[model samples]
Target: MTRSEQLFEEAAQYIPGGVNNPLRSFAGMGQPLRFIRRADESRVYDVDGHVYIDFVCSGGAALLGHNPPLVKKAVLEAVQNGLNYEACAEAELKLAKLIVQLVPSVQMVRMVSSVTEAVLSAVCAARSATGRKRLIRFAGCRHGGFDTAEGDPSGVSLLCGGGQDVLEAQYNDLSSVERLLEENKGQVAAVIIEPLAAHMGVIEPEPEFLQGLRRLCGQSGTILIFDETVTGFRLALGGAQEYYGVKPDMTIFGEILGAGLPAGALGGSRAIMEQLAPVGPVYQADACNGNPVAMAAGFAQLSSVLNQPLLYEKLAREGEALRAGLRELFPECTVGGVGSISSLLFTPGPVKHDRDAKRGDQGQFARYFSHMLQNGIFMMPSQFEPVFLSGAHTERDVEMFLEASAEFLA
Candidate 1:
């Protein structure tokens, strides 16, 4: 057996599913997961020393690519000083300031350990500020693991564990949201959604749909939140909210915001954000919310994006090339989404909602995923997830990927 196989065997004995995250497992691909030793730029080296061009980009966290020199230097400097003080740091303040400047609607920002915590804190803050108990979330738009945003099997509530009042609305369907607001009138605290629904195969909200949502929230006094955890720096430095020109009452961010470090943030107007504890009464705290190392890395990363705006332009051009290549190679498949985030649905026609995405051919996707992996291209094993492009991906990288994809499709 290979070293990776042996490692997986040993890992299975200790770690549940032999991996920390579900996507890391090879269940979807019907093969053993190849353990990666390290990643640099656009490539990852597996345990067997085979290298693959990574399209997953650490699940959209490696915007500037794996361990960019600047981020590494910042992290090293932070570590030399100290890893974590569990106390406030200047890096946190700097990152928060940068975020506020980039996202104008965010007057104040609160740091957290993960996107899940940020979402929970935002939900609590909305509840406290509005004095309401219900929430409305779009179907298949994952806001971390928060129960309030989890989709329900029954197609009614947000999730089974949460109360039935957490209604589920279909993406791009303004009427669904309007109906939910009408049904739960005066009791809905927030309307939370992934501005670009990455979890459900990258469903972008229609202009009218997003405008209607903002107007409905305004009319009903519901707190509108854009969960930009995946789309924050990856889509644009200012996030999908800025890209779509649809501002929300609050924004939740993670992943790329910390330059691959474990960090999250909640940002909104000061009046709404002040509801959190120590300022008001919502009550949310974290021991490592602003870890010094993570904060430093985040600041460095955000500074790079702010200073070098051309990086996004490069990413956009590369993403367009990659998307075009995929369309040419697989004309039978459905390709959707925008910017650096895109997905290939093994079905025909445009997929505008989760229900449409559910019709994708899982078996075909599994085959494609396996072929890509075997041919030195790494992507998420699940059809529901989207692929990410990085500034590090070159024209050569795009060509090699297309060649590999062509062979796989054949």
Candidate 2:
């Protein structure tokens, strides 16, 4: 048996399902699950000593690629100073300042431990700012294991009473959102979405979808929140808000912010952000909020991205090349995504939202994943997730990926 399997078996005795996260379990995956030991620029090394070009990219966090020199150095330096402290650290100020300077919709930012927490806080702040109680989130846009409404497919189950005030809407369909806003009226506090809808196969917004949503929210006095977790630095230095030229009242961030560490933030105009505790009425606090080590790492990563000219241009070129190759190799499948994020769906034709994305054949995708794995390319086992192109990935890596995929089709 492989060492990874052995470790998983051992873990089942103590850890639930032999994995801390459900995705890592590789449940029902055609190939064996991987337990990684180490990672470096563009690749991950499994415990079995196998190396593969990593497309997971830490769920879109390694925008500058794995173990980035600047972020690593900053982390090590901060570690030397110590950890788990309470006092506000200087690193926090620097990172927050850098984020404010980069992201267009984020004039002020409050750090949190994870994207999940940031979502909760952002929703709460929205409600407080508008004095509304209901929230409307798009279907298929998973905002971390959130307790959402009925028939929600974003990984979290709707508990008996957990989502009484939450509402779901169709993505890329502004009419559905308009209806929700009209029906809820003053009760709707916020309309939160992954502007690019990367969670479900990376669907790009239709023309004026985001702009119309912003207009509707403004007309109804509701807060519009753009979840930039996946699209943050990977889309543009200004994120989706700047990329699309449509700004939201509040923005949620994750992934690249902490330099692939456990960190996230909620940011918005001062009027909305000041509603949080110590500044206004809404109360939100965490024992480990804005940890100094995380702050230092995030600052260094952002600084590198800022200093490096044409970084996005290079990443975009690689991403488009990969997408173009995939499209040619698999005429029967659908390839979608923008910027450095891409997706492969078994279904032919366009995928604009959750329903279209769900139409893709999962069983077929499992077979493709198994083929890629056998050929030394590691992608996310699930079809719904996106494939992030890392800055560390090179021409050779892209070539290898396309070759492996072509082999699968053959």
Candidate 3:
């Protein structure tokens, strides 16, 4: 057996499912999970010494790619200074200021340790500010690990314990949102959505749909919250809000904003954000909130991103090349997404929402995944997740991916 297999066997004795995250188990692909030793640049090396081009890119957090020198230098420096102060620091202020300057709608920012905490705080603040109970979330839009809507029991009941009035609407369907608003009326506090639904295989938002959401939220006095955890810095320096020309009332960010570290933040107009404690009544706190190490890492990453004005352009060009290659090679499948994120669907064209994403042939995808892995390409095992490209991924890397994909198709 391989070293990775042996490690997995050892891990299974202690860790649940032999992995910390569900998707890591390779259950969706019906294959044994690879145990990674380390990752650098665009590649991850397994314990067995096998290397694969890592398309997952740490859930798109490593936009500059894994362990970029700038972020690494900042992290090491921060570690030498201290790990956590458990209090306000200059790093936090610097990161917050950068976020405020970059994101269009964020006026005041609150740091957190995870996207889940950020979402919870954002929703809580919205509820407090509006004096309302219900929150509206779209079906395909992921808001971290927590269950943001009723009837979605994917999250632990204990973590989702609260009897918060939550409502779910079909994604890209404005009429569904309007229907919910009509039903909930003044009781609706917020309408939260992933500006681009990466969790549902990179479903791009319909331009009219986002505009309609903004209009409806304004008309209904409900806060529109953009959960840009995956798309924030990766889509554009200003996030999906800037990319699409739609401004949300509040924005929750993670992934690239954290610079591959465990971090999240929620920001909005000061009038609504002040609802959080020490200013208003809504309460939220985390032991690792605004951790110095994470802040330093984020600042480094953000600074590098901002300094490179042509970064997004390169990503866009490469992503388009990859997408076009995939479509050209595999005419039977559908490809979707914008900028650096792309999803390969083993289904028909125009995959717009969760339901359409579900129609992809899972068995075919499982076989395709195995093939890609065999060819030294590491992709997300599930059909539901999108593949990510990073600044570190060269044009050659894209060609390699396309070549491997072509081989698999042949």
In order of lDDT, best first, we have 3, 2, 1
**What is candidate 2's lDDT per residue for 139-256, written digit by digit as tens?**
8897765434454544222421146577779999999998988888889888888999886787899999999999999999999999888988778999988899999999888957
Question: Per-residue alpha-carbon lDDT of model 1 for 1-410, expressed as tens digits?
Answer: 99988999999999998988765778868767899999999999998999999988978888888988899999999999987887888988988999999987799999999887888788889988998988888888887653333333222233222666567788889999999999998999999988888886877787678888999999999999999988887777778888888999999998677788899999999999999889989888888988888889988888887788688888888778888998998888777768788888888767889888899899998888888888898988887888888877888987888898899867
lDDT for each candidate structure? 0.84, 0.85, 0.87
Q: Where does the lowest 10-residue lDDT sum fall in candidate 1?
A: 152-161
Q: What is the Å distance of residue 269 in model 2 from its true position?
A: 0.8
Instruction: Pick the winner on lDDT between candidates 1 and 2.
Output: 2
Write model 3 residue lDDT over 2-31, tens digit each, in one string. Answer: 887788899999999888876676876766
Clashes in predicted model 1 = 0
Count of clashes, each model? 0, 0, 0
State the RMSD for candidate 3: 1.8
Cα miss at 299, model 1 (Å)?
Answer: 0.7
Question: On lDDT, who's better, 1 or 3?
Answer: 3
Give the C-alpha miss distance for residue 331 in model 3, angstroms.
Answer: 2.2
Task: Summing lDDT over every window of 10 consecutive residues in candidate 3, give the lowest-scoring window.
Answer: 153-162
Decoy 2 TM-score against native: 0.96
